[model samples]
Target: MLFFSGKGGVGKSTVTAAMALLAAQQGKRVLVVDVDAKGNLTDLFEHEPVGFKPVEVHPGVHVMTMHTEESLQEYLRLNLRVPVLGRIGPLARALDFVATAAPGVKEILTVGKVCWEVRESIEGRADWDVVLVDAAATGHIVAQLGAPEAIRDLVSVGPVRAQTEWMSDLMHDPAVTALNVVTTPEEMPVNETIELVGRVRSELQVPLGAVIVNRVLPELFTHADEETFEAMRDPAAVNRLVDALGGGPDVARGTTAVLDAARMAVSLRRTRAGHLAELRRAVDLPTLFLPYLFVREHGLRVTRMVAEALGEELGL
Candidate 1:
């Protein structure tokens, strides 16, 4: 299972969707699970409202939005071996109360469901080549993924303990699971990612797969362009350019706007480069870069372009 997580607004959903598409393109049965309540994956696929059941968004790519209530009911139905209880009202409400009252119980149900999928297969063949979880942001992801271990420690001798133990093993096994931390090449996002890597390594003991740098700005200015900009800082150079462009107030204003935009672009690129360098120095993981999409709105077409670029980057 490949779990993708990052700060909110880091475009982790887009990255997860793109990677799922790439996996499907490679003929893998891919399940893209959106654990976030925001249903960002639903938006990315432009699909009808996704419920508990898995919906095929692409050829071999299935998407599902995980809800805590549904996950709890499924967990009880499977573990208790009483399918009727999962549907009945009084039992369902009682189970919901227990899940809500207990901290991390809801999370355990959710993560346990994911682990169950990882361990299941059809006719000795793996059910899914990859289970890509578009998990919650960094603040809550560690707790969500660590739910099994927490429950295991608390419940020493019971069926719940046994279940959590299995889930924990699946998560901790380097061969079975890995985490991908996504971030933009910016200060706070990079800092949060670095911290998240540390926690995942030391606390969760999960294998770190890769650090994905999303929405990286393209470096458009050359060294000569920088020199030209420096020269344009002079009033004489600005006047000359305005005169060359038919010497009017409008021409002067246009020249100023163009220079300002160029300068802003250069500044932004430098900032992103510095953050990328810092991320490399601090986090010891393979870092993948995804370019910023310059579209008015993101849709299936743009997602495909991102998937193609990501495929090339990861050699998928």
Candidate 2:
């Protein structure tokens, strides 16, 4: 099981979806649980939002959303044998209260559900080869993953305590679980990731996984390559190229536009390099960089592109 967390817009959902697809392509049954209320992880596979019930959107990938009510319902039905049977309606508003006052009580509902799926799968009661969680963002992830420890210390002699013991064992086991952070090579995102990494190592029991860097713009040229490209932009060389392609005002404008775009890309990559270096120095974990997609729309098409990139990165 892998929990993916990072800044809200750092493409965390996209990366998680891509990983699900990549795992499916590798013949693994992948279950992706969207832990955010407004999650669009299923949408990346061109499916509409789903409830706690998982929907198999791709060949070997299932997607589901995490709702506190649903998690509680499952907990009662399975753990306590309370037979809720659609009877949690009145307790819905109370969920918010528990979240505010009891803290880990609300978080355990989510994390426990995630850990349940993984344990069931391993024990042969479920069919997931891999469980990927689009977990809470940087601000909330540690608390979410740490719920088991909190509950174990506070509760005694009940299903909840038993749940915590098992979840903690599964979560803390380096072989079974990993928490991976997704971030972009930008100031705020990188800084937040660095801080989150520190917190995870110090405060959480989950083992760290690779830092997945998303939307990276690969440098388009070496210094020598840039010198050659610069020469191509020289007035004389530009004139010759324009004549070679049959010169016209429109052609000249297009040529200038392309050259300017390349120059801007080179500059932008150089600027992001500093942030990437900082992230590397601050976080000692395996890293994978996913190149930026030059697309206007996002859906399964873009998801597949990222999945293919993931396959390459994983040497699949």
Candidate 3:
């Protein structure tokens, strides 16, 4: 199982989609589990998520939302077969409160579902090469990853405690799982990634598979070329930079201005790359860098590109 997470809006879903697609294309039976309530992965696949059932999104790729409430209630009713009043009230009210009342209940259920998937496959009931979970952001991810331990400490015996211990063991097992931290080439996200890595290493002691730098701009110039780009700040030298960059005379004055904009874009791209290289130095894990999209929106095409990049990164 491969888990993908980081700060929100950092292209977590896109990365998840890409990896899932790549795995599927490689003929691996893949399940992309969406742990977020928003069902963004469902949206990416152009499906309206119904929250519980696993829906076939693409060939070899299945999607399911980690509806923790239902999972927990079912876990209680069927597994424990108990008659507890507080957690067994009317559906809506019980679910709402259970989701928000206890801190780790929701997180635990989410992890529990993923763990269940892994166990089912290992038991030979289900066959899958990979389960790619697009997990929640940092704080919640930490709690989710730590759920088994939390529950183990709270419950000493019986089925619930056994369940907790089993989940905890699965998470800590390096052979069955690995984590990928995704972030943009910005300061706060990078810092958060650093903190996240520290927490995972120090607390869980699980080795990260990789740190993915998304929306990266490829290195566009040498120091000398950068000096040339800086010289074009004069506007008078813009034409010369354009000539050196090698575009044709058919470029209208409007086109010249566009070329000037391209130079600025290239410079910014270089700046972002430098920041990414700094991040690569900051973390000890293997790094995968994805290029900035030239288009307006991300969809199947962009995701395919990302998957291609991932394949190259993994040497698959």
Candidate 4:
């Protein structure tokens, strides 16, 4: 089970989707759990919004959107042997009310369901080669994942405790479960990712997977190439290049435009390099960088593009 979490807008869903695609390409059966509640991961696969039940979006890939209420329902039915709330009226609503006062109740519902699926896959009841989770944002993932431990602390003995024991067993085993954080090479995202890694190490039993740095701006030039760029930007060289391009009416303006873009690209890359360096210094985890994609839109096409890049990075 691979749980992907990161600061919002750091391409968490995109990275998870890409990994699903990558695993599928490797002929692995992947179950993608969209825990973000946006249900947007299915959109990338061009599928309609899904509920708690898993839906096959692509060949060898299935998706499910987490719904705590439904998760609770499934939990009750499976563990308590309750027949879809037949005995208890509005049990889900009751959970919502109880969740307001109880911290881990709601979180357990989500995380428990995720772990349950993983357990099924691991025990051969379900045929999932990989369970890739598009987990909650960084702000909530710690609480989300640590819910089982919290619940175990609060409830000393019960079916819940029994269930959480096995879940914790799966979580602490590095060979079975891993949590990966996705981030861009930017200030807030990198800071949050570093903080997250620290918190995960201190507070959670889940094993740390690689830090996937997304949207990393590519280095546009080497030292010698940079010197050449500087020389080309010299006014005389610019004038000569304009002359070489026929020096027509808008020749100088076009030359200036291209130079400005190249300058911005180099400047952005340098600034991002500092943040990447900070991440490397602070977080002692395997890091994978995905290049900033220059695209007009996102979908399976872009997802496949990212998957290809990710596959290459994973040496697939």
Provide backbone clash counts, one per model: 0, 0, 0, 0
Residue 211 miss distance in model 3 (angstroms): 0.6
Estimate every model's Cα lDDT from 0 to 1: 0.86, 0.90, 0.79, 0.91
lDDT ranking, high to low:
4, 2, 1, 3
CA deviation > 4 Å runs, candidate 1? 83-93, 122-126
Among the numbered candidates, top lDDT falls to 4
How high a TM-score does candidate 3 get?
0.87
Per-candidate RMSD, Å: 2.0, 1.9, 3.6, 1.3
lDDT of 2 by residue, 21-47 (tens): 999988999999999767678789998
**Per-residue lDDT of model 1, residues 78-153, tens digit only:** 7887676535677667878987777678788778878888888422445788899998899988888989887877
Instruction: List residue ranges in candidate 2 displaced over 4 A.
Output: 232-248
lDDT of 4 by residue, 1-316 (tens): 9999999999999999999999999999999999887878987887788888998999999999888888887788788886774645576677789987777888888888888888998788989989999998999999988988899888978898888888888888999899999999999999999999999999998999999999988889999999999999999999999999989759999999999999999999999999999999999999998989999998999999999999989999
Clashing pairs in 1: none
Task: Report the lDDT tens digits of candidate 3 across residue range 67-166.
Answer: 7666777677767786654745576466668657665667778888888889888889888779999998876677778777776776668786778877
List the candidate numbers ranked by TM-score, top first.
Answer: 4, 2, 1, 3
Which runs in model 3 stand beyond 4 Å of their true positions? 81-92, 95-101, 227-256
Write down the lDDT that model 2 would get: 0.90
What global local distance difference test value does model 3 have?
0.79
